[model samples]
Target: MVKRVGIRDVAELAGVSISTVSNALNRPGRVSDELVERVRAASDRLGYVPLQAAQQLRVGRSGLLGMTVINIANPFFADMVAGAEDAATAAGLRILVGNASDDIAKELDHLELFERVQVEGALVSPFGPVDAWQERLRKRGVPVVLVDAVDDAGVMPSVSLDDVAGGRLAAEHLIRTGRKRLAFVGAREEVRQVRERLEGARAAVAAHPGVALEPIWTSTATTQRGLAFGDELADRRPEDRPDGIVTSNDHLAMGLLHGLIARGIRVPEDIAVVGYDDIEFAAIAEVPLTSVRQPAREMGRAAAEILIARINGTETPDLTNVVYQPELVIRASTSTAR
Candidate 1:
C-alpha cells in the first residue's frame, strides 16, 4: 500500500512550518491569505487528508453538532432533520444524528455518545425527561438547544410548536361543526407534548357547556391502533358513541379514519375526525383529513440556527424560546356532505 501523506508532507511542499500549515488549514484567520492559499494548494497537490478527529482533539473543537429525536419513523421528525441539516450545512458544520425510537434508555445512550464525541452542541427533541443528561452536557461545555420542546426553567433555548393551541384548534373546529360528544385518542401520557395537547382539548371542551370530551389512551400512535379504536367506537350505539374524534398524530388518525369508512360509517355525517402534524399522507388518504399543521422543517431549522448562535457565542438572553402557532387544515374528513 502507498504511504499515507500527512500535513508534514504538505508543509514541506509549501515550504512552510508545520505550525503555519496547521493554522492555514484549521484556523485560516490566524494565517495570511497568501499562506492559506499556498497551503491549500500544496495540500491538494499532495492528496493529504487530515485526521479530523486528531485535529479536533488538538484544538479542543470538533466542528460537529449532535441531534437526538424520539422517533425517526415519523415524517414530521424526518422533515425536522432535513431542516436542521440545511442550517448545519450553511454554517460549515456537520451533524450526528441519534434516533432514540422513543425509548429513554436509547436516548441516554445517544447522549453519552454525544459526550464522548465532544460535540460542540446538541439539538435535543426528547420524548421523556432528560434534564439531568442536558445538565451533564452543559457541564462539559456543550451548549444544547431543545427542538420541539422547551426547558421549564427557560435556561436552554428551544424551537417548538404551540401544541396546546393545536389541540384547542382541533376541538373548537369540531364544536363549530356541531360535534358535541368528542373523544381524544393519544398514546404515552408520559410524553409532555401529548399531555399538553390533551390539556388544550380539555380546556376547549370545558368552555362549551353542552359539549362532552372523553379521553382515550393507547400504547402507540400507529395506524393499526387507530383502526382498532375506530372499530370499537363504530360498534357502540349512536347515542353512546362520540360524534367527533381528535387524534395525536396523522398515522393513527388516518388508520382510524380508514377503519371507520370500512365499517360502513359515513365520515363527517357519522363522526368527524381531526389529526395533528398535517403530514403529506394526511391530505391524500382515503378521506382527506383535517389536521393541525406543525411547521416541522421550519422549527428544526430555527432550533439549529439558535444552537449555532449559542455555539458561536452570539446568542442573546431572550432568544431562548421560539414557539410557532398551529394552523388548522380543513379537509373532507371534517367537512359535512363533502
Candidate 2:
C-alpha cells in the first residue's frame, strides 16, 4: 500500500514550516497569496489530505452542517437537498445528509452522530414530535433549524409551507367545479402536514352548504396505498362516492389516478383528483394532476441560510417560523367535463 501523505510532506516540498502549511489550508487569508499557492501546489503533488477531526478540534468548528430527511427517494426531497447543497457550497460549507425513514429512534441516533462529529448546526425535517430532544440539543449548545416542519416550542427556527391554505385551495377548486362530495387521501393524520391540510379542507367544506368532506386515512404514504384507497372508493355506490379527491402528495395522486382509470372511471367525468407537493410526476401523469406547489427549493435554500446565520451568530437565537404560501397549479385532472 502507498504511504499516506501528511502536512509535513507538503511543508518539505514547499520549503515552508508545517504551521505555515496548516494556516494556508485553514486560514488562507492569514498567509500571503504566493505562499498559499505554493503550499496548495505542493499538497496537491503529495496527495495530502488534511485530517478533518484534527482540524475541527483545533478550530472548535467543523464547517460541516447536518441535514435529516424522512425519505431521500421522494423527488420532493431530492430537489430540496439539491438546493441545500448549492447553498451550502456557496457558503463554503459541506452538508451531511441522513435519512431517518420516519423512525424516531433512528432520527435521534443521527442527531447524536452529528453532535459527536461536531457539526456546526443541523437542518431537519423531523418525522414526529421532537420536544424531548429540544432540551438535550440546547443543553449541548447545538443549533437546530427545522426544514418543512413547524416550530412548536418557539426555540428552534423553522421553514415550512402553509399546508392549511394549500388544503383549502384544493377543496375550493373542486367545489367551484360543482363537486359537493369530497374526500381527502393521505397518510397518518399525526403528520403535521396531513393534519393541517385536512383542517383547511374542513374549513372550506364548512363554508359551502351541502358540501361534505370524507377523510380517507392510510397507514402508508406509498403509491400502492393510494391505489388501494382509490379502488375501495370505486367500489362504493356512485351516489355515495366522492366526486372530488384531494391527495396529500403527488405520488399518491398518480397512483390513485391509475387505479381509477383501471376501474373504468373517467376523471372529471366521474371523479376529479388534486394533489399536494406538485412534484415532477404531477405534470407528466397520464392526466396532468392539479396540485398545490410547495416552494421546495426555496424552502431548502431558506433553511440553509438560516442555519448558516445561526452558526455565524449573525441572527438572534430566538425561534423563527417562516411559512411560505403554496400556489395552486391547474391541470386536466381537475377540469370540469363539458
Candidate 3:
C-alpha cells in the first residue's frame, strides 16, 4: 500500500516540531508568519493535504455545497457563481468554489476534495471529459448537477446554453448585414462548447453559396491575444481581410476591434465584429460590442436549485437538460444597415 503523507513528514521538512506544524496549519494565529510560511512551503512540497481536507466528514454533515468551474477569471463564470451563491444563501447553505484553472487534473482534484469535505451536493462545470470521475460521486450517493454542460449519459441533469444556435445567430446577423467573407475566431477547439459553436457557424456558411467562413484557431481567448489577431488582420491587404468576424467571446472581439480601429480600419463599413457571452463590459466598450447573450446568472441559479433539491430530496420539475437559448444583442460594432 502507498504510505500516506503524515504531519510528521511536513514537520521534518519544515525543521519544526510536529506541534508547531499543527499549530501553523490549524491555528495560524498561534504561530509567527515565518513559521507558517515555512510549514506551508514544506506541506506543499510534500503534496500534503490539510487535516480538515484529509479528514472524512463526521456523521452529521458539512452544510456546504461545492462548485467547480473551468476558469474563474471569465466574468461569465463569475456571474454564474454569484447566481449559485444567491440560491445557496437563500437555501441556508454555504458554498465552496473549486476553480479548475482550466486543467483537467485540477478539476479531478476538486471533485475528490468535495468528496472528502462531504459536501451535500456538487455543481460541476466541467472543462474536459469527467464521466469516470463523476461516477465516484454517484457511487457515494452524493448528488451532482452538471452546470453549463450536459451529461452525455443522460443520467445527471444539466443547465446549459444552446451554443450552436448562438453561433448560427451571430453568423446569420453578419451575413444579413452584407458581410460575405467571414471568419470565426477563438481558442480551445477541443472544448465542446467552442467546437459546437464552430459547427453552427459552418452550417450558416454552408447555407449561403457566396458567403465563405474561415476558422481561425487561437492559442487562448484573451484581450491580448485578440489584440495580436487584430494587428495581424489589419496587416493583411484590404481584399484579403474578412468583412465580418465572429469571435467565441467578447474579450477577443473587443481586443481585435480596437486593434483594427487603431490601424484605421472602419468597423461595419470595412469589417464588422460579433462576440459571444454579452458580459458587462461588452455593452460599455469604446464602440459598444455586439454579442450573443448567455444567461449565465440564470443558468447558475437553476443548477444550484436543482442540486439543492436533490440534496434535500425535494421535488422538482423535469430537468434532464435545462437548455437556454441564446439572444443576439446588437450594438455599434455590428450596427451598420445593409
Candidate 4:
C-alpha cells in the first residue's frame, strides 16, 4: 500500500522549516510569495494534502459553515444549497450540509454534530422550535442563522419569504379570475409558513363576499398525500367542489395535478391550480403550473452573508429578518380556459 505523504516530507523536500510550510499553507500573507510558490510546488510533488482537522484545531475554528434543511431532496432546498455554495466559495469558506427530514430529533442531532465539529457557524431551517439549542450555541459562541424559517425569538438572524403575501396573491388571482370556491391543500397549519400562508388566503377570501375558502390539511407534504387529497376532491359533487386549488408547495401541486388528470378533470377548465415555490418541475408539468416564486437562492445567499459576518467578528446587524415578497408566475394550469 502506498503511504500518504505528510507536510514534514514537503518541508524537507522544499528545504523550508515546518513553521514556514504551515505559514505558507494557512496564512500565505505571512510568508513571501517566492517561498509560498516553492512550498506549494513541493507539496504538489509529494501529493501532500493538508490536515484540515489539525489546522482547524490550531485555528480554534473551522472555516466550515454548517447548514441544516428539512428535505435535501426538495428542489427548493437544492436551489438554496446551490446559492449557499456559491456564496461560501466566493468568501473562501466551505459548507457542510445536513438533512433533518423534518424530524425534531434529527434536527437536534445535526446541531450536536455541528457543535462537536466546531463549525464557525450554522444556518438552519428548523423542524420545530430551536430556542433551547440556539441558546446553547450562543453560549458556546457559535452563531446561528435561520433559513426559510421565522425567528420568533428575535435572537437569530433569518431569511424567509413573505408567505402571507404569497398566499394572498394566489387567492386574489383566483378570485379575480372568477373562482369563488377555493381550496388550500397543504401540510398542517402548525408550520409557520403554512400558517402565514393560510392567514393571507383568509384575508383575501374575506375581501370578496360569497367567496369560500376551504382548508385541506394533511400530515405529510408527500406526493401520495397530495394524490389522496386530489382523489377525494375529484369525487365531490360539482357544486360542492372547489373551482380553484392553492397548494403549499410545488411537489404537492404536481401530485394533485396528476390525480386530477387521471380522473379526467381538465385543469383550469374545471379546477384551476396554483402552487408555491415555483420549482423547475412546476413549469415542466403536463399542464405547466402557475406558482408563487420564492427567492430561494437569495435567501441562501443572505443566510451565508449573515453567518460569514458573524464568523469574521464583524458586528452582525441585529437579528435581521429578511422577508422577500413572492412573485406570481402565471401558466396554463391557472388559465381561464382549458
- Find the candidate with the highest lDDT and give its number: 1
Q: What TM-score does model 1 achieve against the real structure?
A: 0.86
lDDT of 3 by residue, 29-118 (tens): 999999999999999999988655333244366778999998888899999999999999999887899998778889999899988878
lDDT of 1 by residue, 84-198 (tens): 9999999988999999887889999999999999888999999879675877887888899999998898778899899999999999999999999999999988888998998
Predicted structure 1: lDDT: 0.92
Per-model TM values vs. the true structure: 0.86, 0.86, 0.82, 0.86
**Which pairs clash in model 4?**
none
Q: What tens digits encode model 2's per-residue C-alpha lDDT throughout 156-266?
A: 899899999999999999999999999998886777888999999999999999999999888877788778877987898999989999998888898899889889899
Model 1 stretches with alpha carbons more than 4 Å out:
1-50
Give a tens-digit lDDT track for model 4, residues 31-119: 99999999999999988999887787786868789999988877899889888888899998899999988677888999999999888
Worst 10 residues of 2 by lDDT: 313-322
How badly does each model clash, as a count of residue pairs?
0, 0, 0, 0
Q: What stretches of model 3 exceed 4 Å from their correct place? A: 1-59
lDDT of 2 at 59: 67
| Candidate 2 ranges with C-alpha deviation above 4 Å | 1-48, 316-319
